[model samples]
Every structure is written in structure tokens, then in C-alpha cells.
Target: MVRNRELLSSGNAAFAGLASSFSELSETLDRLASVADDRTAARAAGLKARLEEFSAKITFVGQVKAGKSALTNILAATPGLLPSDVNPWTSVVTTVAINTKAPADVEGPTNTKARFTFFSRDEWDNLVVGGGRLGELAERSGAQEELADIQRQVQAMRDATKARLGRHFELLLGQNHSYGYVDPELVERYVCLGDDVTPGEGNPQTGRFADITKSAELFLDIPEYDVSLTLCDTPGVNDTFMMREQITLRSLRGSELCVVVLSAHQALSTVDMALMRIISNLENRQIILFVNRVDELQDPAGQIDEIRSGILATLKKFNIASDVGIVFGSAKWGEAALMGSYDGLSADSRKALEQFGAMHPELAGRDEWETAWNLSGLPGLLNAVAERVSEGAGKRLLERVRRNARNLTNEARATLMARRSGGAAVTVDFAGHSASSVMQQLAAKYESDVAEVCQQLRDDLMQRMQSAESGFVKRATDSLLEHLERHGESGTWQYDPTGLRVLQRAAYLSFARAMSAKLSKLYEDAARHVEAIYSAVLSEAEGEFRIEAPHAPRVPAPVGLGKTIALDLQSTWWRRWWQKRRGYEAFAKDYAHLIRAEANSITRDLEENQVASVLENARAILREFLKEHQETIRRITQPDADTAEDARKALGVLQAGTDTGAAFGEILRGLDDMAA
Candidate 1:
């Protein structure tokens, strides 16, 4: 177990660093923005927005029916807040935020309410018409059966939506709208059982919640914990098709830690392995492998050992460098036990417990059962998570904020240098050419060099992206096509989500995994390009001037870019949600074209815009140097007192904000405040 004192100290230290750094950086940027031109101000605003958007992400991931929702309840310490019995196929991403301080606007004792966001009508129509991108591609390739299956699923979802939503169905499809302040008492009414479509008088019984809601969020004050925590309950990895899975993966990219829930009965299943592999690929993220339902095992200890060994072996085989903390427990028993109501267990669960007791007469007593139930490892798990958050996640978040501050500090220093050195500009005559002409020639040469490096980078990275995109899409398309070709109409929907739509869902998962790899590569490639460009530009500029651009920070891994392509591509409703803007028929007819077009568009967005943006920023550094020399000489020679005052004020603002010692002092003070 992580030491509580260590965790507290770490949290205080990290939070202090973050608060002070951000405060200083924000002040400096404000000062800079006041004096900067419109273009520079806009760019600074963009950077500021990015920094402000930094929030600690915690993602919950696991396989279908692994009691992930139950685990969520345990983590939140709010039993039954989320529907534990929700259909796994409906991949709705739910988020729960615990406030450290109660809201001033709210009247009561930190009341919990959920705000549900629904999908637009256009998105649903697109999914119906296009049959999703993979389905459409399969259809075009003469895979009639696969297309028909997709059409059937679409029709089923549409029919279910109408039956469940009734008149309200139309209300939800309009746009990205919110339905909020829903009482905690009726949380289940909004999230549970996708097919519960019966309409009631006052209570909205008829709601296509699974179909409509893209995501839901719950906010409440948890007075127990000292630190604020936001927990995300995501869809099971194999719950839906490709699209929602990708969304979950994209969400994971931002998360500091991932708690992977696994069922003891089926430990390290294929889908579990896939999900584990995904998290392992993510750099600088912590992981916890939680094996739920351990109470069901005949020999819990032996089974847990076997499960752990298997997981370790598989992770090694996959070459994942993750050190996962393994927790063995039963989410069901733990939740019920925590609520102080063992009778809350379903009749089926009660019967199962009885059978287990009968199987082992030696352990058949209320005391043993109580101990078993309490020994659900719930307390230990919570403590571990909190420690990790305080020790690792908090520090990482602070470090990222500091990196942004450092970058801004470099910018401020360069601007100061420009202002100070402008008066001492040197001019030289070279080979019958004027100093300005020679400078222009040098700029032109470096510009070409910059362009060449950028182009080569684009060529290499874009090719890799294109190759992966094409191959994965084709493979996914081909799998569905072949399945249809092989088993025309024999597939049936089973009670288990993994059983129903198995072929298509499996194909979707495979494709999603491929796309994730592709996306990770794209981010890695872009980061590399950014670093190379900055280094090259800095070298070239150093030859002429002392001013240089800041080193590129470790860019966060880019996810969700493939999400820009044609459809949700997931077996779930994300495809429906994503296609909100396009007409169904047009999307369907040109689905393949749309897929290719979207891929190209994303590639261009990254290869052209993103790469160019950073390089352009680098060039701005060089331009600033040149401009500084030119302006300073003119100002010094003219000796305008009024202009000098304005410059001095700007310089003063920066100097006050950029005091390293003062900032560190504030950081220390902040730590003291946290301790207090």
C-alpha cells in the first residue's frame, strides 16, 4: 500500500508547482498580449487556451461484462449511481466528478445531478443511409449479406429508438443539446437498460438514452476526500463496434491512469489482452489490472495467481513496459457490502452465494461471508488509486503546466532581447551587396531549407499514415465482406453482447486496434517532425543571430484523428453520433470515397497545417530577431522619450512576471497553503 503521508506531501508539492507556474505564465502572457500585434496575440491566445484545457484524465477500461460499471460505483463510493446492469453493447461514456468544495450556487448538501448530452438527428439519419463506412464498403464490394446485416442493425436501432423515445425521439435528434439537473434519485432512469422505452406521465419512461446520449456527466461534492477527483466510466472494449472503442481509446490518451477491470471467470480473455495492449502503448500512463468477481472462484488465491501470471506473460510477449498493480475482488459484493445492505444482492446472486457456501461447508457462516464480502479489496483499491493520483498523475499534470511556462518564458526572454538589442544593429557591405540584400538572401536560403525538411517529413510520415489507413480499412472491409460471403444469414443475436454481432464487432475491434496504432504513429511522427524542425531552424538562426526558438515539449499523443473519417466505424452508436452533419444517402453512395477523402483530409490537416504551424512559429522567432535589430537602431538614433517609456513599461511587466526566484517562492508558499 502507498503511504498516506507520502501521497499527501507529493500532492501538495505537485499542486503548488502547477498553481504557481500557471499563475506566473498567465500573468506574463497577459502582459505580452497587451503589447503584441493582432497576429501574435491570436497565437498567444491559442497557446493559452491549450494550457487552460489541461485537466487530469482518469479512464476506466475493461472487457465486456467485466463489471466495469460496478467497479465505477466502487470507485465513486456511490453504489448504484450508474446502472451496473446496463447493456454492454450500448457504449455510453459516463463521467463522474467529485468536487472538493461544494458549489456556492447550490443550496443543499452537495447534491448530485447528471447532465446528459444527446446526439443530433442528422447523425442518426447518416448511420441509417450509409450503413456505416465499413458496411458501405462491404456493400460496394458485392458483399450483399454484410450490407444487409448492417442495414438490419440500423433498422433495429431506429425502430428501438422510435418505440422507446416516442415523440421525445424527435426532440433529441436536433443538435448537441443538454438535459440536466436531473435528480440523483432518477439517475438510473436516464442511464440504465437501453430498451426501457415505455413513456410515463411525469417520468420520461420513453427515452432512447443509449441511442441518443453521446456522453453523460455527474457532478457532486464528496466531502470525504481532501483532493478533487473526476472518474470516467467508459465503455467495455469489445462492447460495441469500432467507433465507440476508438472514442474510449482517444479518451484514454488524456488519462493519467487506467483501471482495467477483468472477470476472474474469464481472466485475460482475448479482448482483455487487446485492451491491455492498447494501454501499454500509451507512454507515461499508470495502470491497475483489477480482477473482479474473485468470490466466484473455487480457490480464489490459486486462481488469482494463475490470472496474474498469465497477464504478466502476455504483457511480456507483447513487449508492453507497463507495471500494473493487480487487485483481486468482487465488485458486486463490495458495492453491496459498502452500502451496508447485503440483502440488496439479486435473488440470483444470493442463490450463487448459497451454492458456494454449500460447496465449502467449512466456510459456511455469516461471519465468513461477511469477511469474504468485506475482503472485496475495495478499500485497498481506492487507497491505491488515490495514492497514484497524488504521487504520479498530479506531478505529471504539474510538469506539463511547467513545460508550457518554460516555453512562454523563453518567448518572453527573446522579446526582451529584441527590445534591448534593437539600438545596436550592425550593417555590413558584402561582395558589392547591401547588408539588407545579403540578409534577405540568407533568409531565402534558410526558408528553402526549412521547406525541404518539412516536405521530406511530410512525405515520410504521411506515407506511413496512408499505408496503415489503407491497409486497416481494407482489412476491416474485407473481413466483413468475407463473413457475409461465408455465412449469408446464419448469424443470430445472443444474450451476451460479445456473442451478438460477434463477427462484425470482432472485425470492428481489430480495425480499431489498427487505427489506434496508426494514430499513435502519426502523433509520434508529428512530434519528431516538430523537434527536428525546431532544432534545424535553431541551428540555422544561431549562425546569424543569438536568438533561438524553445525546444518542443513532449507533445501529447494525438488520438481521435481517425475519428474524422467517414463513420463512427464502431459497432456502437458513435458512428450515428459522428455522422450528424452529412446526409445519409450521399454518405452511403460515396461511402468509400468519403472514407478515403476523410483520411486524406486528416492527413493534410496534420502534415500540412500542424507541421506548418510549428515551423511558421519557428520562422517567427527568426523574423523577430531581424525586426528587433532594425527597430532598435532606428529608435536609438531617434531617441524618442515617449516611445521609450512605453517600451520600459512593457519590459517592466515582463520582468515582474518572469522572476524565477519569486515564482519558486510562490510555489513553496502554495505548498504551505496545501498543507494548511
Candidate 2:
């Protein structure tokens, strides 16, 4: 624990230093903007906004009852802020926005500290009427009984919701509820399942809105850290209804880091194949596996290695990366430590902490509470998160900010020198040079090429989806036939979806890699063109000034591809369908048709939701990149006369021995250091 803290302390200090540097840099930009031209001032303002808005989004994902909420609360340093006993079926994606500005999507009064967004009417209608993906699965599998059951359940839920909220239930859809302040009770009102309370009969404040709530965003102030952090507690993957699974996937869209929580006793159990599939699909993300509830183990010191080994083997078996960081801890220990209550600890927990402490000489003499906290492994996990942020998003943001700062500062210096040198007589011919036209041509070509690639990939994926679906149906049919032959259709036959999952994963990976690579190349080409134009413009200036090339935009990997399909569900639909089967030939044909129908939905989802979305995002990025660079070219080529005059006046004031030049030089040095 001492070692973990040391590492965590170091990581925190390093991240704090980086944030301080950004703050200092932003301040310098503010000062510079006061005496700079319009273009420079605008650039400075933009940089400031980017710096202020930067946040490292991290999500916690795991199977149901995996202690995700408890771990999230511990990490956020707000124990019990989120309901640890949240129902597994709750679809809300709770975000703890710490040390950050409220998200733009959050709407309400300025003082609103918590926001609960309800599902849109369309979304709700789809879920209720369509029975979500599960209904589609049931319908395709000919499981009339299951389909009716799901519809009944959804109807009951809706009726209960309407009873609780009355007419306001209809009004609340597609709207949000906001609060001036947030507390556990208020949160439970919207997020808890309140299974203890009979429908429409309990305290209205308890889980009254959980059924309709789509997401919850809580603003929190934690001054211990400097950088903005958004910790997302996603719905569990192993949800019974699979509604939360889709919600979880959407929650993971923009998250750069994921913490997969696992129970020590059932780490990577067969029931958690959904969790494993999620891990396998997050190929480009930083993953941390936290084996929670280690205190439940009889020999914490002796069992940890074995558990870790088993987890690694499972990951390998699923073709997931084995290099993910694994930490063993108990959220109970974290809670106990945070409350400074040692007496609250169970005998088993206390004994586990003692054994953990004994294994590490540095922890031998530490306070029992502190030792327990260390044994909780929160510090180590926190340190890992901090390290990833520093090396990944933090580093990338700093580099881009520094580059832009350097270019803007250098441009300001060059403009001042040119004015002083009386370069007004120089007639640099920019006639017939249309950066806009050239960029448009380039952008059009890039878009066309990207479209071609997307179409090709989409077609290929469609083919693969069909092939995989056919293969799955054939295998399932054969398995059923064997079962029928052996037991004469009297017993149940479980059809594994592992083969389908593998095929889907491969298709997703192929699409992601291809799109990522193509987008990166296109962006690089666009950036290069912009750089060349900027260089040409600079070459025509009075003095020698070198501008740094614009950094390539960070293209987010494809999302929605990792989503859980209807086929992934484990149910008795197969047996139920088989019970009404005819002869082997007729049974096989009907089964194939039904399974194919279900598989076709997966194809449509991938194409419409995943593939189309990726293409649209890529195009938007390309267009935005080109648009910004075109503006940059215009700024360089066509300077505003009034702004130039204002800059001259500001420069004259600085030239009057105000030491502002020295300040500017210091800012440049800071940027250089940051870049280094």
C-alpha cells in the first residue's frame, strides 16, 4: 500500500504539474491576446477554450454485481455518491463529472448540479413496442412464449411508471430533470430500482424515475486534483434484459480508458462472456481489470496470484489482450478506509488486510486503516489511471496546444518585425492563388476516396455477416439434430454463440483498423497541404520565420461495433422452439430461416448504426479539418487592416519599454519546454 501510494502520489503530482503548465500557458495567451491582432487573439481564445474543456473520460465496465458502482464511488472520492445496490437492469449511464465544467448536453438553470436525462419518446416507444433487441431476437427465434413474456414485462413497467408519474410520464420523455444540489437520496430517486417498494405504492422519492432515466450527470468539485476527470459508471454488461448492454456500449463510445471490475470468486466466469466479448472488442482502449472483493478470499496473499493467472488465461482464451493491468482489491476496504472506521471491517476483511500487509515489509508497521486502504488497491488503480491519462490524452492535448501556441507566437513576432522593417512596399503576388479552391478540390477527392473505401468495407462486412450467420445457423441446427437424436427432443439443447461472437469481432476489428488507417492518412495529407500553403505564405514575408505544421486530428475509433447482439443472449428460446419442431429436414429449414432473420438484424445494425456512423464521423472530421485550415490560410493571406493597425498601436505601447516583449519571450520558452 505504501508503494502504491508513492506511485499514486508521484502520478498525481505529475498530472498536477501538467495542469499547472496548461494554466500558466493559458494565462500567457490571455496576456498576449490583449496586445495581438484579431487572428492571434481569436486563436489564443480558442486554445484557452480547448485547454479548459479538456477532460479524460474513463468508464467502469463489468458484469452485473461486479462492484463497479462501489469502485467508482471510491475513485471519485465520494463514497456512497452512487448507489452501490443499483439494480442490474437499470439502463442509466451515470457520469461523475469531477473538476470539470458541466457537459454541453446538460440543460437547466445555471445552478443545476445534477441532471437526469430521460429517454426520448421514440426510444421508449421502440423499447416498449419493439421489445428492444431481445424482442426482435425472440420473434426471429419463434419463441412466442418468450416474446409474449417480454412484452408483458415491458407493459407492466410502463403501467407502473405511468401510475407513479401520471400524465407527467408522457411529458418527461425526451426531457431532463435538474436539481440545484445532489445527494444520495436524490440520486436514488432517479437511479435506484426500488424493488423493495411495490409498484406505484412506495415513497415517490425512491426510484420513481429509474425506469425512464437514460443517463445521469452529477457535477462534483474535487479540488485535490487539477485536471478535469469524467468517471462514468456504465450499466453492467451481463444485464438480464440486454437493454442495459446497448446502453453500456453507447456509454463507452468516447471513453479512452476502461476499468473492468470482476468479483474475486467468479472472475471471468462463463456467465461473464459478455464482459469478455466487450474487452475483446476494445482493442484500442486502455483496459484495467480490477478483481474486486478480494477480502472474501480465505487466503488473500495466496489466492491473488492464482486468480490473476486464471483471469489471464480466460482473456487469452477469448483472444483478448493479456497485457491489461490487473489489480486485486475490495471496495469494502476502500469504503472503510475513506470513513476512517476500522471497527466496521469484518473479521475476514481484517485478516485479509493483515495477511496482505505481512506480504509487504513496508506495510508491516503502517496503521491498520491505512493498510486496509492500501489493500483495497484503489491507490494502485488510481495510479494506473493517472499514468494512462498523462501518457495518452494529457500528452496529446499538451502537444497540440503547444504547437498552436508556438505558431501563433512566432506569427505575432514576425508581424511586428515586418512592420518595423517597413515591408509595406513589398508586393508579394498572391493573385490567382486560391487556397480555398485547392482545398476544396483536395477535400472532395479525399471524401470520394473515403466513400469508396467505406462502401467496399461495408459490402465486405455484409458478406461476412451473411456467411457468419449462415454458419451459425448450420452449427445450431446440427447441434439440435444431435440433441434430438440422443434425447428425442425431450431435453434442452444450449447453442453457444461463441462462434458468432468471434466472427463479429473479426469484422469489427477489420472495419476499425481500415477506417482508422484511411482517416489518418487522409488527415495527414490534408495537414501537409495546409503546411505547404502556410510555408509558401511565410516565405513571401519580410523575415525568415518557420511555422510548425498543424498536428493531425485524433480520429476516434469506431463505436457501436462492440455492441451486444440479440444472438448473444442466453435463454431457453432454442428449447422452446425445438419443442414444436417437425421432422429433421423441416425443423432444420425452419430453424435456419428464423436464425437468419435474426442474423439479418445484426447486419442492419452494423451497417446503419455502426458502419454508417463511422463514415459520417470520418467525413465530418475531414470537413472540419479542411475548414479550419482554409480559415488559417485566409488569415495569413488576407490580414484585416483595422486589426493590423490595432496590433501596431499595441506594439508601439510594448516598444515603450513595458517589458511585454520579455514576457512574450518567456511564454515562448514555456511553450518550447512543454513541447520538449
Candidate of highest TM-score: 2
- Find the 10 residues in a row with the least total lDDT in model 1: 492-501
| Residue pair clashes in candidate 2 | none
TM-scores of the candidates in the order shown? 0.58, 0.85
Error of 1 at 268 (Å): 1.5
Worst 10 contiguous positions by lDDT, candidate 2 = 1-10
Off by over 4 Å in 1: 1-54, 100-113, 133-137, 140-142, 166-171, 177-186, 195-206, 223-228, 239-243, 271-280, 284-286, 333-375, 378-396, 403-455, 464-676
Tens-digit lDDT string for candidate 1 (411-485): 333333434433233333456754445445545554455455545544555556677556555554454445546
lDDT of 2 by residue, 196-220 (tens): 6666786758888999999999988
What's the true lDDT of residue 9 in model 2?
Answer: 39
Cα RMSD, each candidate:
11.4, 4.5
Score candidate 1 by TM-score against the native. Answer: 0.58
